[model samples]
Target: MLDELLARIEGRDFTIGIIGMGYVGLPLALTAVDRGFRVLGFDVDPDRVAQLNAGVSAIKHIPSASIAAAVSAGSFSATCDMNRLGEPDAILIAVPTPLDRHQDPDLSYVVKSTEAIARRLRAGQLVVLESTTWPGTTTEVMKPILEAGGLRAGKDFFLAFSPEREDPGNPKYSNAIIPKVVGADDPASRALACRLYDNLVAGTVPVSSSATAEAVKLTENIFRSVNIALVNELKLIYDAMGINVWEVIDAAKSKPFGYMAFYPGPGLGGHCIPIDPFYLSWKAREFEVPTRFIELAGLINNAMPQHVVHRLAEAIDKQSGRGLNGARVLIIGMAYKKNVDDMRESPSLRLTELIEARGAHTDYHDPHIPVIPRTREHAALAGRQSVALTPEVLASYDAVLIATDHDDVDWGHVVAHARLVVDTRNACAGIDTDKVVRA
Candidate 1:
């Protein structure tokens, strides 16, 4: 069985099914198709399925031409059906692993995906979980579910964990180029998973166990969260001392060795950095061990959005000669990153909510995201259109806060027109503006 599977993978004849066809899954599916594999993208969202089937790319980085090419070639298709799972030689779960209200790991989506796959489990099929979650999720939580199908993991079906390392809006790396880490419940499963990924990606690094692979993904995010928090803390300190943190980062980045530059921002955003670290921290509590650094970093990163609100309030008070009450503040961007439309765990939403709660009228402008869905906190502000980025409109706000520094936004116009500016992303750099304040 293993030898036949390896042959199929090497020959690129393997049919790859990617569950949860969102940002991560769509790119992976398209990359597999580009690498000469038949790909099936599965998503519960009917709208997403419709969009993909129509050759329309929902993700910002994925080109519509790629989707059109794949669909026209009959190498890729999107569906909401679970019964089609039986056709794939390998299944990859890219479902979301979000946190609940109390910051606990929410495994409902994972469990649902696992159940969908288990119902169609057959011999000689490999299942890999690519969702970021706590360590042992593959070996402990998903293993039993797959085994309940009257088949064992290593003997009947192969299982592994390879966390998704997707950086949206980063042009340097794509799904086919990123180094993937693969680990399994046993050596045979590990080898099979590695071979499958090796056929598509640039490189595949195999680890000892699925737990270690899971931990590797979590650790990477935790490192980012910590470093970003460190820079954010430094930003506050430097601001108090009247030193520009961006200049300090630029100077320090000149070092050739032992230095990695992480810029300060409104806060840590995106699905991975802000949320993935807590999965490990939550799991650690079961062993009576507290992840102090992870907790501290999260605390500082989460608090930054509120701190931005405070700073914006101060700037508004100073410039407008009034309190936050009835003040019109414009947020420059709404996406988590500069150029992507993804808003999962975005700090901009939190900052906007904070501003609105403080009695300030808040509006945002993003070329990428014109309308934001109502989240838990921003439910009242749903269906709001993005404000125009013209100089005259920008001048109408009492203060403008640059939340996400999108490349398409006219920063010079914003600097030239806004009455007062609070830039959390240092978007106002190189612009001659006395009204600018950097967080």
Candidate 2:
């Protein structure tokens, strides 16, 4: 079984099945198809599957032309059927591993995906989990489920873990070019996973155990979360001193090797930084280890939305002599970061909720997101459409809050027309006016 699977992988004559066709799985499927392998994408969302099958792209960064090309080449297709799980020579799980309401590591999605694959377990197939999860999940959680069907891992089938490194809208990187870290308990599973990704990506970094690979991904995100928290703390400190944190960072980053600039924003966002740190913290409690630094960083990052909202209220009161109550505020950007429509763990949603909680009315303007869709936490913000950034629209607002630093917006137009602008991302850096204030 191993030799046959290896030969098929070498010859590119095998099918690759990917589960959870979102930001990670779809790109992986497209990359595999580009590498001369047939690919199948599985998703629970019927609408998403139908849209992908009809050659429409669900993600904004990924073009429809690419999906259309993959479908036209007969190498890629999306489906909601889990019964076809055993048909592919290799199955990759790229599902979400979000934290629960209590901020505990939620592996429900991962567990469900594994259960579906276990029902159709077959020999000569490799199963690799690409989800960012707790360190021992591949072996501790998934192994038992996959072995429940009377097949052994690394013998009847192979198992590995390789976390996905996907940066949406980052032109410099893609799933196919990023170096993958592949690890497994057995050498055969590790080699097979490495060989597969080496053919798909730029290179592979092999590790001794799946736990190490899992820890590597968590550490990466934790590093980002900590640095962002540091800068966020610095932003507050410098604000008290009446010093511009953005200018300080711009100059401090000029030192080539010593400083890597991480800007302070409204708060953390995206799939990894906001949520992946808690996965490790939750797992750390199993061994009675206290992750104080991680928990502190999480606290600091979580407090940013409230700080921005407070600043908005203060600015509104100072300028208009009125509180957030009965104020009509316009948020400049709706999506988490810049030039992307992904709002997975965005702080903007919390800002909207907080602003409304204080009796202020909130509207948003985003180039990418036309109408706000329902989110897991911010479902009440559903169906709210993006308003235009016209002169009349800008003038009508009590305060224009710049939450995201998307390059598509006109800062000049906003400052020229709005009564007051509260800049959270330092989006309007050089605009010197009493109407514009950095939050």
Per candidate, the number of residue pairs that clash is: 0, 0
In model 2, the runs with Cα more than 4 Å from the true position are: none
Give the alpha carbon lDDT tens digit for every residue of 38-92 in model 2.
9999999999999998899989999999999999889999999999998998999
lDDT of each: 0.89, 0.93
Q: Which regions of candidate 1 fall more than 4 Å away from where they truly are?
A: none
How close is every model to the real structure, measured as TM-score?
0.98, 0.99
- What value does the lDDT take at residue 124 in candidate 2? 78
Candidate 1 lDDT by residue in tens digits, 1-439 = 9999999888887899999888888888988997899999999989989988889998877899999899989999999999998889999999988889888999999999999899999998999999999999998889899889699999999999998988877889987899899988799999999999998899999999999999999989899999999999999999899999999999999999999999988887788998988898899989999789899999999899988888888888887678688999998888888999988878888888788888989889999988987776457767988989787898889989999999888888888888888999888789876889876
